[model samples]
Target: MPSLGSFVLTCIIIAISLVLSVSASVGNIKSGPSPRRFMSGSQRHNATFSLTQIRNTKWEPREMSTTAVYAAEFLKHKVQMPKVLRLAWEKLKLHDDQSSNSSIHRRVDGQLVRYSDGQYVFPVTIGTPKQTLNLIFDTASGDFWVWSWLMPMDMLQNRKYYNGSASSDATPWDGQSWGATYAVGSNYGIVWQDIVWIDAIGVAGNPIECSQGVSNWFASLPGVDGVLGLSYAYNDSEKPEPQQTWITYILPLLAAPVFTVSLVHNGIGTIDFGFIDQKKYTGSIVYTPITIIPGGGAFWAFNWTGFAIGSDKYNRTNIQVMTDTGGNISMMPESIANRYYKLVAGSYKQANGAWIFPCKASLPNFVFGVGSSRIVVAGKNFILTNLPDGINCIGGIQSREEDTYVFLSIPFMQSIFVVHDYGKMRMGFANRTWV
Candidate 1:
């Protein structure tokens, strides 16, 4: 048997290759959830969509379970989304000790959704009263911050909501007094108060207590009230580190040698605690040094090799790829997409809703390049070949989309065993069974 260390190292190598070797292509239509089991070779599924009317959507507070323990099973199977990228859990241990890490859980539509929103919410929290918060967890960014959405409005009058606003147990970023600020994104607009204070963030039930640098941006979305930022660094670098981010405060506290995440298909993934899972990995952990995007805080990134339509490679080069939980679709270059459609003898078509195409009975494989490496990956279905012209170009396809197709949403994360410990500053991956 391999030594424990050797076994873990081997697993990391396999995990990295598995992720990087996924082929880029489109596939045939299907009508079901994504496959929850892993396969030796690439597979593809077609994606379809229909807009659902938002009806009877209302908010009700679900009591946080008093029990701390929960049952967990190993995960398997995988799916992909084209235009939407498969996202990984952006993690930061606030205090560093094993016990300091909070189980990250998500409240989807209020119930213990177990899984966080794929691209909608962050499993993080902020404030002195320990106000629970979530964010668009972006691996490319490193700043830890929060926003206010669907706040009771009356809570604003409670004064406790503004713990950082009053500078009571709270501190300010760069001596700046608490005040309201505004910003915008691809989605909604935001207006918030900038404040600083300790944050108690939780994931899957694990909690971490630490100081944070945050924004009080507020919106009107229920179930999702605020963002939980996880950028490499904050917008203001001069601010004290604690006042800057929770990740920064936790990086130095880890006892583990490295970390990793498996954004598998289905709601069946795990974040390794002390080390990578040896049973699921194959070789040494592949380490690639990455340069953060100009505005990205410290999200890790790598280069993509090529994409293909069916067996023929699209032949585009120099594409960049990053695993992002903030993005909901697999995205890529439009030129590459055009080439893919041409190969399949399929043309992009505009639908009554989101434009779609005639998904061939045969699925085309898509590959993503990472730092001169390429990995073969599958798609939810063949129907949604690529994004519409105005939509973002995605070589980065999400696995699950419609019923039969696998979505690259948080559910896919359950497919792979993962860990992202800050202390090690390294990522690990493992192949787990969805069964």
Candidate 2:
């Protein structure tokens, strides 16, 4: 009924109106409070997930024409239009996904309760019906594994095992196997896929390895059923076929590619995914670039500039250090460890391989540098516990082979709030506020 040009104009107007309407809807949804559903009964009490805002403001700007005057004007005004549009698009997509109740761009907080053995364990639910298990959230490992029904009955006594048959979403991955050898022990098992839930955030089709057998060291772990590794996906121990880490699969569903760990002594710690709690730490977060270990190890390795014991400062160059939540003691190079102990009078290495000192000895103040920031670990924190006789006390910092890398364990972690930035391959640390 209308001319070609008029009809074309009409279609264009309709298309633009539709796009604007959809965009306005998305903006409204993102600005409003998202609907939350809770699991009825005790399950609801065990897990409480909430979204937190991301603190980092860094953004990547889109490339623009060098000759464009408007581009220069945008830069002069400190407004990156391309980046802003990209962020808006991301928000729109995230809102659509959240509305579908399939995925969410929200920060998730998981409770970490300290165990008697000085290790912290967190809860992770697996499968369709949701079987919850307390797992050691190890930052050094790259595999998400659990003790399974496939193991011997005696070995499974008092230990929870994943019953794959009971999970409707469980899918077997035949021929895929994974094995990991830790300083404590080893575990081996078959790889499978299922829904893995941390707090209330569910990652469907999550790759998980169910351990068929474990060494005595692993079996002896108190109140731990398995490990949920937080290391990069490339470090997965699945031989012949390596799969992505659990975090990798869930990253897309998060608002930010960051996770924060706050460890408290003999108390409940917390792991925040997608955001950092500014209130948990003091001062600005100092970020240090990750040092990739030769041969590609999965540890959260970083550079250590130097260390100080009281007024004495020891400078180092290119020293690579790592943090592991699974380890209880901080292990440093033998020479450095000796030097540190020397600063504390009466501290000596015993025949039992422990470095012990008088329980009442005044320990030297210790601090370590990462980049431009210095993290001070109070000398009192280095004293783990006194002997039963209450004379000699065990030191938190111990000596390892000179070739062995330095490992910052629970003692060091407890004093700082750490951020593991997978997207940037950097580690950020800030002093934790003792409550």
Candidate 3:
């Protein structure tokens, strides 16, 4: 009917219109308030079976270009919190035999510690009441230490502070012979030179041989006596490299491409290296752009959505939000919460405890303001069902401790994949289905 050129032009116009239409449809679907878009109720309860059936062992491992200009630009700096020393003076040391690969030794488990109000506390067995003391365990740095100074005068006179004075039940180190360094930072970093043979070794999971014992000064938390460095690469010669534990202990046995750390309340935690749990992975994996801090390693981060006290979507509310792997509960400003309570569908107490009454007619879903999008999380995901009414009334609103902060704690990580592919500066999220 029509000339060849005219017919071709007509086809092109039709194709363009189709593309535009399809794109618009997709954008609308993603942008729309598609409640429970990823799954139905029955599906959510049974999602774990789907997750277990997934074989994460299969991987066509391709090394990505870790160096990218765009990635560098997307990097966010690590949060530097003000920490002070709790115990007066504690000194600990580490050593390298020069023969074993750093990776193999990184898998050991030290004491699990908890942080609160800028202080750290953990039980230490030093063979006797006089020799033993409480210490702080830190993962941000490397270097094992104990308070060597400011000892109880009675304990000082009766026991040993690893000062080559008394031998209790433990094996003594011989650091007196080898060359060591005594380094201290203005922030209570300490290091001392000595050739000490470590009698017992501890770390995260596996313990290893102890050939030499060296100590160094470390910037520590306030009110915390000891610091346990879970960081990598103390020799300073290793770069563009993961710490020994990250490489040898964790990466070697991982069944999946990613791992998550879930630190539950009271220091009970689990580290899932390969996949997401079925219970938490009911929704689509949401990805937020993150900036990684180089050299300091990957600081766990996320796109901050606004904090929701209850189920009400706070997309319109402007609130400051932060995530802390170290934080145990959702902490919010009382002023903002007091005002928000009126709009929420719940009641509360005036005194010590906080509780919630979730109505079937309306379950609260709070939406957070991320980089560009609003992330809606239902109360079921944020609050526990076991609480009295399952809500804490801070100020006046029934606020469930929300994990909307940037630091993906163990419980929150159980709900999402917090992927940290170091140095590249980008993180990814896929529903547990994708994990």
Against the true structure, candidate 3 has what lDDT?
0.27
- lDDT, candidate 1, 1-435, per-residue tens: 000110111111111111111111112312221112211221112211111111112222221101100000001111232221111111111111233222222211111211112212223334334464433333322333333332345534422222334322232222221111221001111122222222221211111111222212122223333333343445222211222344443333234434445443322232332345566544334444443444333554444445555677456565443444333333334454455555444443221112233333334655543334444444432222122233222122222233231112222233334344354454333334343
Candidate whose lDDT is highest: 2
Candidate 1 segments whose C-alpha is farther than 4 A from its true place = 1-130, 134-136, 147-168, 172-220, 234-244, 266-274, 279-285, 294-297, 307-309, 313-318, 343-355, 358-363, 369-374, 381-435
User: For each candidate, what TM-score against the reference?
Assistant: 0.48, 0.70, 0.35
RMSD vs true structure, all candidates:
19.3, 23.6, 24.2
Each model's C-alpha lDDT?
A: 0.29, 0.57, 0.27
Write candidate 3's Cα lDDT for 177-282 as tens digits: 1111221111111222222221121112121111122121111222223323233224111112212432222332334445443322222233343455545444
TM-score between model 3 and native:
0.35
In model 3, which runs have C-alpha deviations exceeding 4 angstroms? 1-189, 192-258, 265-267, 274-280, 292-298, 305-322, 329-417, 427-435
Question: What is the full ranking by TM-score, best candidate first?
Answer: 2, 1, 3
Return whichever of 1 and 3 wins on lDDT.
1
